[model samples]
Target: MFEDAFKLKIRPDGLEKAAARTYVTAVRDVLEKIHRTACGKALLQSIRFHGYVVNIIPYPGADVCGADVDGDYDAATGIVMPTVRYTPGNFAKGGSCSHLPGRGWAESILFHELVHALRDIAQGKRRVYKGVVMTGGLHRYDTFEEFIAVLCEDIYVSERGNPHRLLGDHRGIAPLDPALADSFRFFATGSQTFRFVERFCRENPGFTKMLSRVPARFNPIAAYYKDPRKAQSFSNSPAAHERDADGVWGKLFERERSPTLPTGSPANLPPPRPASTPIRRP
Candidate 1:
């Protein structure tokens, strides 16, 4: 079972067989570790993304690149396939995640593809989108989905800050790392964003009343991650001003200003990234 799980049989020209085996082993090790505990669910979900494979054929003018997931779900096999490509050059020989020896981007690509698979399983064809499963396609996620991936990456990075891994460096791109943080920045950001939108809708209910006409797109989950005060049209009224002065909406207000909250499991991680990103290798 383990062998089947970690297998990487596709061979690329100018790529070493030994290094390829090692990369497969590393991926298997991470998956095996995650599978042993309750935390394995996320990692396991990613395996279903194992689908069509491709090699990164290098061109002289090309820049370093990695695998991309094309979101087409294999209805027959129930798997989402990602095409893993490697750069052709000395970089490939370096074994860096950005290079051939590096499987960092591969891991992230796999995980991201799996997310599409999971979404399909949960929401069915109703929520399916296109172009997310192929190489370079994972970057096209919707705003909320992007947030989810970012937050997960933040948590993974903070928990497993290994020196040899090049993944989960979402700090610079987003104020709050998507991976769960010790301070829970992502949660706080999301919560604030949610409250803001919810309160805005209440104030001018008609402005977005049409949103309720359709159920799926205007989900509460999207609102759950926003700040009430930041709603586009929200303004401080006399009553709202008084409440703010009196701190009546203490919890709500606090969410925007570092609201204290519970912690999450330590094992959560973000999808891996290319070495070009600011991630330390583990």
Candidate 2:
């Protein structure tokens, strides 16, 4: 492990020597894939690597191959990445996901978890976007956080391509319901990861909750928003994802009447949104 340059610790927990080695190697490969572009590097820098830990424990009953825990506020403390092969999900030892920039299942899953960690970072109290601080709010669950994370996972796959679900790429983008097609189309297809998130805040308006509603209210400084819902943080409830009158997601959710629809990019559609101003943390 000393020779590996990935900063975070990969705690094999109780795995034998060979299993532990595999986990360590997976760390190296994920870091390589994540550093392949400038946007990927932004994702890495947003979630600083110090004190981050990757645990090798299976989330069997949970049906997940990987997971992330909410940090005290600004960052997630660590991530759970199972070393055991998840064949049902087509994630196996040394197997690669059938997606763009195609890479190992471990890399794909870890990248997704890293997005979760990044979300926690973005929702921090002191993060001023445009001008005002992004405090006291939660981009909670299936509607908000997962929206960015999955879109991000696909964009990470596409690099610079529009992340709209393409033919045969069912694993990631395929699962979204029809109404979200436009949401994904509008957000993911336009910008790379960093701008996608920054614009999401601007476009969606109040998708993130009020700072007064969260723990950040008490100790505004040095405090970031945190999720207390445990594994259910992905829950997309009316409260957690209240549709704002002028918010983009609000408009997207209004089309709920459309039943299950297949994922496909139409020949004629809206062009990519103009590039937003550069985003920076204060």
Candidate 3:
């Protein structure tokens, strides 16, 4: 089912075709390994149950190495990824590859998006944390959602045996605060990983300060949820909802607690969507 859910295709150009095949093979190996892990199995089950398909397309000369359209989880539909042309040079410069060795950059980004897809289904439209809302929108790079996704990507990389590479990909998008960067490095390297996130947020004023600087346009819940009536309709109170979101994160961090896999067998899972036809751009 995991294999069927993720489909990769490239534009017909010779270079892109070769790159796509290489990336697809690498990504498949990573996903297969993930399927064997306790937390990964839960994520796969959630993605399958939600009927989410990940369609990846590799395009030449793209500015960003990879990007997904909005509404990835809206109504539980799948995600669309139009990736940048995969070249060793581009991968190295893309920032996601900084901490990864060889092809691990591709694997890390793929896993990062997979983490987003899993959280999209788990958190739904109304998830609110510490007054930051995610209703009717996606998470910004600086949000807790991204934090969790990055953390998951790091955990995956660590489990693959290069624990030192944790958050190398994230440094590009994360704030440039030396303290914050050091903190992430410490968390990635430390024994008490998840506990550090909880503690750091409490102890570090910089965390909230950096979050406050994120442009309002990047935050979906900022405008709509600010209205007292709208906020109340979503939850009893902001504090309560924040705690609920924390609980969800706690479960995601724990490998032993698996959300019951959606009912029915693999055959009942939805088939992969037809591949997107590539169009030649001048």
Candidate 4:
């Protein structure tokens, strides 16, 4: 069942066989865990529906550890092609990082990319535009995407009680206002986090404006918040802002039990560059 839901493809010149096997095993374990969980089952169903494939490749000396290859999301067929490319040079000869050994780094990258794939699946078939222009104009959207992924990674790692295994660092790129991060963290768990994010964008015009540039279907916030389960999820959680007696939203931030650990720098570090272009629909 797990094999059918996720297909792993390693480039011929990617990590060596031993390293690749280790990475593949780690990925399978993560997917298995997700498949077993309630929220994960729903996400797995969406992934299966889209026929998303996970490709592992050698990073071409770029600083990025992984990318979701937005262009590969085929709305027509509901297929999403996501990849977790690695910087082979960054790993020690045996595919271990000095900071985190064995397939740890690669596992982190895979988890980060998986979160992205899940988000794409949840959003359904919407036109996805990539590049610096779309990212620059809608900086908040990009940050929000990273925020949710990192937060999910943090939750997974926390559940395992292993701080060192946390994935992609968000300190620089996706720095959420600490208070805001805490509030949303308390509000939802697993895939339900998407609902909190969508509500967030609706409350913040800066985020709403950026989402508006994309097609309505691709606007993750608007789409996922409308899910019938969204309201129910909120009602069940004590962390829901509406249940707070304190008038300040930041008060809800206090309910977060687990805090994120520093995951270090991202691979494929691109020099911060800005561009101006309206995100387009296909």
Candidate 5:
């Protein structure tokens, strides 16, 4: 039904039709595989009903990002990604060296971006997956977004024979962490009763590094990814020491799994570089 879930627009000139068809087919197959599972089916439904046909353009940029989706989030066009650099291999100076993925890996990467597209559109909304409330856009730092995407991406990877297909930090650290694999194991056997937040937060999944990399302008984000003892005010970084635990990222960020916790779900700015900032494609 979502034959157009991702509309491929070739912005660059002189691209071959064969190249375009390959990408389109690869992405479609990924969706088909995800739809086979119960959880995947539900996720796909969430995006469809959200009034987003998710525009998927193969980004051709020099930046090392494999793919990223962050913008104003158009209802009709879904999360508009002006710079989704979906390509093979590590993006040049990737965190560490690793073998580049084959064209088949593109399908898996598309699945990764789909996680982003889902999270982006669900902002300001709430949905329950496997009894876990995906308060998609609520957090000040938007931590759960990456955790969930990486989690779901890894789950899909399991179905693909468990390759090195994680967000970034976790990529190549394979045999997928048993803790992370536990949830997918449930879904693989037709169960969705995953402890989304407990296990996910317990593992932390290099979220600090992800958030630390965010630009200073993206308020509510922290400074360093190493330790949390340092308190940086969510609103005013200068007043961090003056604030309390909530002020710093102590335990409040662990609300991802709290079904009872309330939740809510990046964007553009004006200046020399006004393009939308992606939600870390690494």
Candidate 6:
């Protein structure tokens, strides 16, 4: 299994090597914990992102920033090629993920890169693999896939509610909520497709508990909002009765999760809510 693992092209020098390795180990430990608690679908998300990082390469005598090279999702060969780079002086410097003390901070740096991986996977930039068989394929997403991804991120971040823990007192770090919302608007119609899933995961005790079961490899941010139970909708019904008003109303009331242009308030909307947001942890 290790044979197929992509060998590091640019090994870190001196202390850099040890630091990077330490970061990788720390990230691996986090993955193990997540595996024990994250949603299973998140595993699918991770499979698309694993083994594609090419890191610790020497500075190419230039100042270009890191970038995602691969394009869309592929069904065969689970690798998406992306190049992440940092000029010696222009990267995150301290805390749990820092490089100043010569400690590996790949987890902190790679956190956003992982988000790019998800974007690439959902956009069809990643190639799926089965054993040694590798075939190239692409999936241009429709609006629905985009909606689901957006809503999932919102649900994930909101539930985790550990912005400071993840953000590490950095002013430069983009707000997860706004960043997710931006992605939704850029790639999708911003439709209301996941209100049910989001609300159910937020309010239903049974579903909330299942979130811990989510696979570690998967983005906890995405899986938190994508409860599979939301897939169930009443047939040919505009005003479906919600068994648990708080737990079931969002899904039944709003078929989609996207916001509107006019932007009406929640109270003004009737059944099948025109607009809604993620479930608050409080």
Q: TM per model?
A: 0.40, 0.44, 0.42, 0.46, 0.45, 0.33
Model 3 pairs in collision = none
Choose the strongest candidate by TM-score: 4
Computed on alpha carbons, the lDDT of every model, listed in order, comes to 0.33, 0.36, 0.40, 0.41, 0.40, 0.31
TM-score of 6: 0.33
| Tens-place lDDT digits, model 4, residues 1-282 | 355545545453556778767655555565565555333443345455555565655555333332333425665676455655444334334432333332333334445556666555444444333322112112223355565566455444433344343332343233333323332333332233444455445434342333333332122333333453553464346543332332122222322311331243222123422222111101
Worst 10 residues of 5 by lDDT: 264-273
What tens-digit string does per-residue lDDT give for candidate 3 at 1-282? 347853323233454667657756654565676666543554455556555454443434444454332224343333322232333333444553343333455455655666655445434422422323221111112355555566555555544554234452232432222322332222322222333244323433332223223332222122222342442333343433454455445434432332333332111111321222111111
lDDT of 6 at 277: 26
Deviation in Å, model 3, residue 95 alpha carbon: 13
Model 3 segments more than 4 A misplaced: 5-30, 36-39, 59-61, 64-103, 125-141, 173-282
Task: List candidate 2 stretches off by more than 4 Å.
Answer: 1-7, 49-90, 93-105, 122-141, 160-282
What ranking of all candidate models by lDDT puts the best one first?
4, 5, 3, 2, 1, 6
Tens digit of per-residue lDDT, candidate 2, span 148-247: 5554554444443433332111122233333323322222221222233544545323322221132211111111123222212222333223322223
Model 1: per-residue Cα lDDT over 52-72, one tens digit each: 332222222223333222344
- Backbone clashes, each candidate: 39, 1, 0, 6, 5, 30
How does residue 210 of candidate 2 score in lDDT?
29
**Tens digit of per-residue lDDT, candidate 6, span 1-282:** 121232223344343766767644444443343333243235323533343443433234322223222333333754444433322223345331232222222323333333334444333432332212101100111122222333343334433433232221111222333322332221111122234334434433343345445332323323333433322232112322221232244333333443542453332114332222211100
Better of 3 and 5 by TM-score: 5
Candidate 2: the clashing residue pairs are 136-211
What C-alpha lDDT, on a 0 to 100 scale, does residue 137 get in candidate 1?
12
Leading candidate by lDDT? 4
Which RMSD does model 1 reach against the true structure? 14.9
TM-score of 4: 0.46
